[model samples]
Target: MNATGEGEAAPRQIEVLASVRGRVMCMDSAYDVDEANRGRDVCVNSSYCGVLPARFIAEHRPRAAIGMDCGVGPEGSAIAGLWYLEALGIPAAVADVMTAHLGDGVHLYHHGIVSFANQPALDCGVTAGMAVREAAALLLEHDPVAAAASEITNRTVMETTPDGRSVVAADSIAFGTSEDTDRNVLVTAGHTGRSAVPYLRRCRPFGFICSDGGRGLNDSGMAGLYLVEADGLAGATVDARRARMGSGLSHYHDGIISAVNALAAAAGVEIGMACPQAAHHLLHRRPPTASPVP
Candidate 1:
């Protein structure tokens, strides 16, 4: 897909986890897939295999793509993306939320256990319970196809807090812009992983919240909180069970707090508070000056 449009420079490389016959990349969100690495395989810690992310990967036409199953929540919405990719004849699969941290791609590659595989992936020797590295090897054996139209989901300003800050709901933090700055509070449906740190550090929103991804394996799901806290961003994650993993609107309306960084705690966010309440406190307060990055 020409989503990047004519003359768009190829996007810079995201973290490359391995390079065999083809590159094996790991990213925080599926939106990280781009024209630059069009045919490489990727594993993202978006915590859900929904069509939104699938479309992002399919748009780039990767040889294969893998994402977390996110407990295959209500209506199986979490793993629904697998079928979407299947229809496009792309090899795609998902790791069990329990076997790997939902937000850490490196962990997914090294420790994840495949819980589901679409027919295309299955045809290439990918199977449930297989090691991610083994599945990625099989993925490389598949041929890349022409790009499909990519769908970019839009973020919504759910409400303007009493203090004038916008409380934005985004299907993924990947939609955030530098304009969000200290003027907006973001509630995203993606996981809080280490890959999220760089994006948050760059965007510098007033405050932010995302999913805990069931706090899977070594608490890797919310691991980005401390990393961002070091940058002085007040951040938190809501329990995956309390809200859908891939819907920001569901997060804002149904989420219950699962964890909070120090800055968020200082702002009165608690583990059991409703997401709206926490977002309110975040909009009303600001973290200390973030340490300058190199």
Candidate 2:
């Protein structure tokens, strides 16, 4: 038995065979000799792969032989075992993908265990249970609280331009020091399909200038960039962040923070480098307040 209170034995394999048998029975060609021969071959193979080994242990009582014969070795045997288990209605457990950096190149790993649910595919870059665990751990390394805050405060808006062009607008929050306090607001909107650089240039016409996220531009929408502002900006930023995180707007490969940062940079804004926990608290820790600025 596994953790979920389900048996480790194969059960779904029987269900598959039952389904196939039902289909065969309904077919007019079921009486064909060739089909009959094929069916016999399938049954024999299924029995050899599925029923025989299980029955050997359950009925014959040859304990040592069962263990020895069932030992994992060649891929062919592993495949046979998998097919057998499938035939027997047994479910197998598979691994998840893992990503790792070694020197310069990235490495993919896989788990060895078999599973029916959550089965990792080839090219999934996972090979072992340990690899799946490690990948999960790596993902969790980012502070959930901070990620939540980031997601809430950043907003990505899509609009159509006057010239029949689709445009994307991104607004975010930024900090202002006493010396340069022009209510440091980052407002970046651009032609939707083009790269960030051209979009930044377009926004420049509307007093949206600055590239605080970084030096170069990333055309990939996967990047997180947001336009920043001051005044009611902090509150708006916090509120947005809270709303997004609460609504489950952020997701895998979405790069919410990266997009926010990119937009902030394009708008020449400065953002506070707060810890993820602190950011989360800032976004969700406060109560609602009425705003006079529209």
Candidate 3:
């Protein structure tokens, strides 16, 4: 059992769930927001209303956007991003974490319940307790706002092993690269959901860590860690409550390890360990044998 008295259940396998509806799109991560979806309505799985993520979404200029509420963390930081979108004149809403998987946008669209809506979204007829599909439809009724200027942010190289392996902090695993294969440790801010599996499989980083996203909805939030374990890649997740979500620097410096896959555990990662210490162990461990990509 975990510190919370919850058993470590099996992680469910899922795909990159997405759908396009005329001018509307549903995707699993905010990183997926791009020129292709610009001027469209979108729903993504990134924490609903996170400041950084909101800014990212705003850059794409979607007519409206929906995201996961992230359990509305400390001082309402989780939903605070909605205010940014509201100011941009874009309607935005967040799904209740309890009603949908935190990192799967298609699941959110089909099963999510709206927990909060910014003023602009409210004006668009989105309301608390509304179904995500219904809310997204309402968002479609609005027109796109001018895109926000994109920000320039770079990944941080947090630590380097004596052998030259580096620990890199990226806001999302989508930032991972082919060069990461067998060469680095990546600490990311996104959840360890099944949608993340492909990135880990493709990059095959020596080790990695991501947020547990409050372990929402049957602990589906950290589901990708187990899949990575099957590939012999060391992996673990930070407790979402211990650090700000969507900030990899926070995951590396302020996070507490909440779960560890068998491969990570074998490398000396334990639940409750400091994230930096776990990264140390992972950086020093030998890379696992390459596994076939799914």
For candidate 1, write residues 1-294 as lDDT tens digits.
Answer: 112234533333345455565677776577777785666655444347888888878888877888889888887898899989988878889998888765566667778889988757866788888988788777876653433323333377877966667989887877678778977989998889888787788888989999998998999999998888766789999999889876788899999999999999999999999999999899888547666999
| lDDT measured at residue 194 in model 1 versus the true structure, 0 to 100 | 82
Model 1 steric clash total: 0
Give stretches of model 2 more than 4 Å off. Answer: 1-12, 15-224, 228-294
Q: lDDT tens string, model 2, 18-90?
A: 2322211111111111223222111111111223343332232110010111233364342243334333332
Pairs that collide in candidate 1 are: none
Q: List model 3 lDDT by residue over 1-294, tens digit each.
A: 222345652122222233454355666677677776666545444456789889988888877788988889998898888888888787888989999876666678788899988756766778889998888777776543344322212378999877778999987887888878988999998899999999889988989999998998989999999977767789999999998777788899999999999999989999999999999999987666567999
The lDDT for every candidate, in the order shown, is 0.79, 0.24, 0.79
Clashing residue pairs found in predicted model 3? 48-68, 49-81
Better of 1 and 3 by TM-score: 3
Winning model by TM-score: 3
Give all candidate RMSDs, comma-separated. Answer: 17.5, 19.2, 17.6
Off by over 4 Å in 3: 1-74, 77-153, 289-294
